[model samples]
Target: MEEIEETPEEHLAKQHRKEKKDMQAKIQSMKNAIPKNDKKRRKQMTEEIAKIEADLNNKHEEELSQLKSSTDTKVEEVLNGVETMKMEGGKEAEAEAAEEEEEEEEEEEATQPRVTKAQKRRDKKATQEKERESRIAEAEVLNLQGVRHQEGLKLAQKLATKQLQIKEISSDGHCMYRAIEDQLAQRTKPEITMSMKELRSRTAEFMRGHADDFLPFLTNSNTGDMYTTDEFEKYCSDVEHTAAWGGQLELRALTQVLLLPMEVIQADSPPIKIGEEFDSEPVTLIYMRHAYGLGEHYNSVEQLKDPANAEDS
Candidate 1:
């Protein structure tokens, strides 16, 4: 007002009191809003009020000391008591508001879905099963590829054999083989008798020479070969020869023999001598040749089979 202005101290005191009143009202509102079930919220509210009161009391220390130092003990006591009461009021309000907030949170939690222990376990098992299945399928695919490759080898052999022709006698070189005309040899006399013992002996000698390829066909009990029955079947499986190149199994066998590790075969194999003879009959010869090895493919199969000459073989 133009008539009079309040002193600085008075203006400050008035502002402080108004601020104190607002704080008290806020605390009271907080208390009223506090729910009955929230003790934690109540405690927090009380702590907050205490903090505010401590701040206010620290700021008003000068006025409080002056009043106490003056000759007014009774007045100081009364004023201090009143200040304590105001601080308590603010604290009570805050406590109530915190309690209400805590209660609302509890209610929300109660409304959410709950999972049982059994359901959680079942879900975990299902996930594990799916992972296991994926692993099994991957393993199966690898196994299938191996089987397919073996089948392809067998098919190639069967095709080559069917289409193979016996060419006329060429130079007796071990590496040379050719396709020749399919001419039937004159039928042998029925009276001509061949010794089974001789054929067996010859076949056994021949097999010993070229043991690498034949070993896979024979059962392990017969000769310590490692191929399983299924593996053997896959290797020996028949194939339909196509007309493109006139497939013959003999050609396939010859190719395989060429690639065989010399160390695993007889060393002294006689040079392949397919004389002009039977074109219709398939002659399965087992040459007495040395196994091709790091240094020797000229040793005889009989020499290799001998235990005494094992080292040299």
Candidate 2:
């Protein structure tokens, strides 16, 4: 039998159907390529597929509308029946395509390397343990200031007789205030304990009120130039509101505000006392020294009974 050549309209319809089938295949491939665990990519692929499917539906409707408008009554009835069958076929094909895609995904997942829940838990635990060990090593190194680790241990032993224990404070530029707060909490009645915030406000107020007494000493350490009025006011503001690092000048101000003697103890140096005129009795001893290039850290000292003496007694 001789093959009949298709009309231009029939050829166009054939081309559209082929193009739509190719688009569907591409959509299926894209869906399969995306990993099930990749939610972002999957969402993107879903949107793209939806757009392509909408285009295909629009094309189909346009072709049907053209065929109905151009054809006679009998031909239109025939085209309508064909359209119904095409719709049914399209639905069945879509259902089959969906099933195939799901099966492909399952097979791909089964072949991929899997991490068990138990293995994941073990990995997390190991990571935490390593972090903990690293922190402990850093803390140990921090204890040895300028001396070797062994020498530091010996110094600590020697100071043990004096019953000195260094209590570390946060180096958040408010170390002095925190250290003072800690000491005050220890010595004063519970109701009278001063918070760091309160201490900062009080110190700023005292320094501003007694500007004449402190201004001379508050000169720039390097330039030896006295602070201008504006500079002094900004300094007072920083001390009151900002987390400005405290220095000896601030310490002097604090001594006047608290009216308590403050002593600083250093290795191989005599104790330095401030506010001695205000009070004969010493309130607290703060340890000051460079800590592994961490500048200076001030820690309050707590005296305890000598372990050896306690054992002997």
Candidate 3:
């Protein structure tokens, strides 16, 4: 029995059919053996089948290329049918391919040598960098909180200083202010209080220059007929009603007596004798008496009796 010569088209078709059948069988076998979680093994098997199919197709292409043109339509039909099948099964194929690739990669990695100390060092540095960044972020948050706390402290100090100023200006004694300062110290120390000593020295200097004005309010025993600053304030405002005279105290006459110009005084006018002026002058010179003694007060008015009195007044 002699071997019969098959046409090129028939040969190519036969080879294509054989490969397609083999691919289907391999696919079925893989589907049956594969576990849902054994994706790695499944991928490897699918890849092997695909390689085989590729080789078969390459062979068919070579054979078809050498054949006459008459079988073009038949070859195209078969190729188109294969393409359609691939399109329909593309998602499944991709999934299987990915799983297989992962399995192969993992196997390869397993076989590879362990990482060196240098590689571990690099990984450690990367981890350390990440940890450092996390710490820096945490530090930034803490710093923001600290800033807010500092700002609050500053505001509190400012308020405390203002309160202290008011207290110093209004308090009756130094002991009272000291008590208040000590109480404030038990809580957070106020920044403004730190400068209180300087503030006090400045206030004392100012008070010294204006001591005469304030002396009237001092201890009556030492002052001897002088009014205190508080008394003076009340007297000036006309709030003090305990005086000998009643009704609105006319101070304009006293101001005129004190401010009278030396040149303006008519020399011919009756000389304002000491007892005569006090007896006749309607205005009460309380501040003058409060500032100077009764005798000095009389001398002041007597000096002012003439134009030379301007210098004395």
* Best prediction by TM-score: 2
Task: Give the poorly placed runs of model 2, Cα more than 4 Å off.
Answer: 1-159, 188-191, 220-224, 278-281, 309-313
C-alpha lDDT of candidate 3 relative to the true structure? 0.41
Candidate 2 vs candidate 3, TM-score winner? 2
The lDDT of each candidate is 0.41, 0.69, 0.41
lDDT for model 2, please. 0.69
- Per residue, candidate 1 scores C-alpha lDDT tens digits across 55-170 of 88787776656655653776688999979877887977768888999999999889966778997777777766765586568656765656333433343333233332122222
Pitting candidate 2 against candidate 3, the one with the higher lDDT is: 2
lDDT of 3 by residue, 5-101 (tens): 5577665775577567756754554444333333466577678768877887788778777675657777898999979978988889968988999
Per-model TM values vs. the true structure: 0.20, 0.51, 0.19
Rank the candidate models, highest TM-score first.
2, 1, 3
In the predicted model 2, the residue pairs found to clash are: none
Candidate 2: tens digits of C-alpha lDDT, residues 1-313: 1224557577677668667766865665465444343357678778988998998889888987887677667687899997987788897787898899999999999997888999778877776676558656875777556453443344355456667666668655577789888888777343346888998899899899988877887654346689778767777887889776676778888887777888876654666789889744455555555432323556665665466763343
Residue 40's C-alpha lDDT in candidate 2? 71
For model 1 the local lDDT of residue 286 reads 24
Q: What are the clashing pairs of model 3? A: 43-100, 216-227, 216-228, 217-228, 217-229
